[model samples]
Target: MKGIVLENKILNDKYGIICIKSDEFAQNAAPGQFLMIRPQPYDYIYDPLLRRPLGICDINEKKGTFSLLYMIVGKGTKLLSKIKKKTELSFSEPLGTGFNLTTDKKVAIIGGGVGIAPMTFLSKILHENNEVDVFYGGAEEKDILLTHIFEEYSNNLIIATEDGSIGHKGFITEVFENSLKFNNYDKIFACGPKPMLKAVYDIIDIEKIEFEVSLEERMACGIGACLGCIISTIGTDPNSNSQKRCCVEGPVFNGKEIIWETVCKE
Candidate 1:
């Protein structure tokens, strides 16, 4: 499908938000699904042949717009950063399975840096019927972008910075740990650096809390065909004792089923 870039600007020194006009895509998009974006502006097509995968940050059905939040990393994203208003781009959207929004109404969704992007839509839909708490962290003040959006959708939006420049002066993980001491979350979902997701899983694994985590990987083909984004899984599947493509079968997966150390090992 095709969409027009309505807004594209920096969130901070590290991140940018790109909003697009696409009614059909926005109406059908599910939380955690991504769009393979290929910028085709001013005869610059095919320079970066592979489209980058970005999570759908938000959707406004009435306005005919859907937004993608991205970090300005690498050559592909740098080109994406240059997109101006009204420029049309190619997209392969609503791809892969999104977060499991069907259960555990009282949910804790934790995100860090660019990882916070995907949590927006998930929080929005879940907020309508569930108690949603969002915890976010960054290296410094600038990295802690988009607090207001999360605040709008969450019952409680907790902020943390490692530099102590903002809310809690520690890892978002520390806040998560302390929160679990008293407040019992029915379910937990996390996206960010793998280490953060692993921490969330470790703390609650013993208690048997349900959790789903969205992953990141490099994909040649966003669908399963290319197999460029395979990662090991502990769960029983064809990839059980083997590996699963992060582009399919997951971008979201059972937290308890992932062998954190082995799968995350470099």
Candidate 2:
């Protein structure tokens, strides 16, 4: 792991939300990829084990820095939240294959909850060469963060919250369905809750739209050394059938290539 000091921090909520700006190493990271971080001071309390994997939210190539936005969801994250600026952090980064972007295509990116992190990065990159649209979903207004970033890159920005406190009063899928009537996109990129992904998969399956999905699975050894993050796939080999490791093989996969029924079964 490489050790780098936290250059800046911004707290966004009571759940210990914040963005950490790290050194130039993060600039090497791609959109839809992540870094594994562990608080330096918490080594004794939590060491030798993989740290929490945080998606690369944004990057400043000119400044030689990148950002990671995360919520305090566990002991590791809580300890990370307490880290002061200038404190050194240990990390293994620029991990995982990123989204596949085909030039000259109309692409729609969808995200829910924390899954929105990577989508922000993807939107920025796609905006440089293709028509980009974004759909973000949250339980309420507070759950929605970084809409401004997405708006800057997307040609169309749609928001959905369960309480009707934001753009649409229903699920993001509703916005997706409604938008499809007016806009025909060539590809879809999605990441969010399992149910949301499944629903999207079903929709795209019927519509015959090509798509890619970034999946969230419990992982250990983010580099795939450990078999802790296995996900099933439909293989073409005539004699074989089974699961694959999400960490090593992908966090991103061709939406149609995924065995949705098997994945939902587990």
Candidate 3:
């Protein structure tokens, strides 16, 4: 359906936040789910014809609005940044599987860079009924987008920046690992670059903790039609693996189910 752009705030040279007024999207959006939006300001100017997949960053059900945090990665997203307020953009229904929400347990939420977008809503929902700890990391201070918002929804907000511009001086994973040693978290949810997810996968004790990771991929068709967003996952037989569409089967999956080597290689 078509959604009107309520606001498009550019965070920096690299990142921006766009809010859209879509009652259908806001009411239905779940953490980790994404929507595909065409970037052009007008439907006819379709130079970048394909719809860009953006994670559902925040939702205001009563206000009938949803936000997307995106990076200026290519022509599509660059155009997305220039979209004006009140402009109507074409958006797909909220797509992909969202994180499974569980309550009454200690939970760890990890995010890095723009990957932090989807975690906000998840943290908000989880914090209401669970002890939530959020670990956010970025390459620099500019990479940290919405800490104030995260703080409102988490019991503890831990931050790290590689250039020592923010909270911790090292990788966010390092802080996460340290926290894991002290906290017996019952569940964990993460979304970041693949290497960060792999690093997280390596540190967590999967047998003792349930962990899920939201993956990032380039998609041609946000629905399952195109086979462009396929990823490898473990099959019933250890020697083989099965393929899954990132746009449909998941953007969220158990960390254990992913074949890390394949993800790292891609």
TM-score of each: 0.94, 0.90, 0.98
lDDT of each: 0.85, 0.77, 0.93
Q: Rank the candidates by lDDT, best first.
A: 3, 1, 2
Better of 2 and 3 by TM-score: 3
lDDT of 3 by residue, 1-266 (tens): 89899999999999999999989889888999999999976777758889899999999999999999999989999999999999998899999999999889999999999999999989989988999999999999999989898889999999999998999999999999998778999999999999999999899888989999999898999899999999899989888899999999899999989999998899
| TM-score, cand. 3 vs. native | 0.98
Error of model 1, residue 136, in angstroms: 0.6
- Residue 185's lDDT within candidate 2 is 86
Model 2 lDDT vs. the true structure? Answer: 0.77
> Candidate 2: where is the Cα deviation over 4 Å?
1-11, 14-24, 40-42, 47-49, 238-240
Against the true structure, candidate 1 reaches a TM-score of: 0.94
Clashing pairs in 1: none
Ten residues in sequence with the least summed lDDT for candidate 3: 40-49
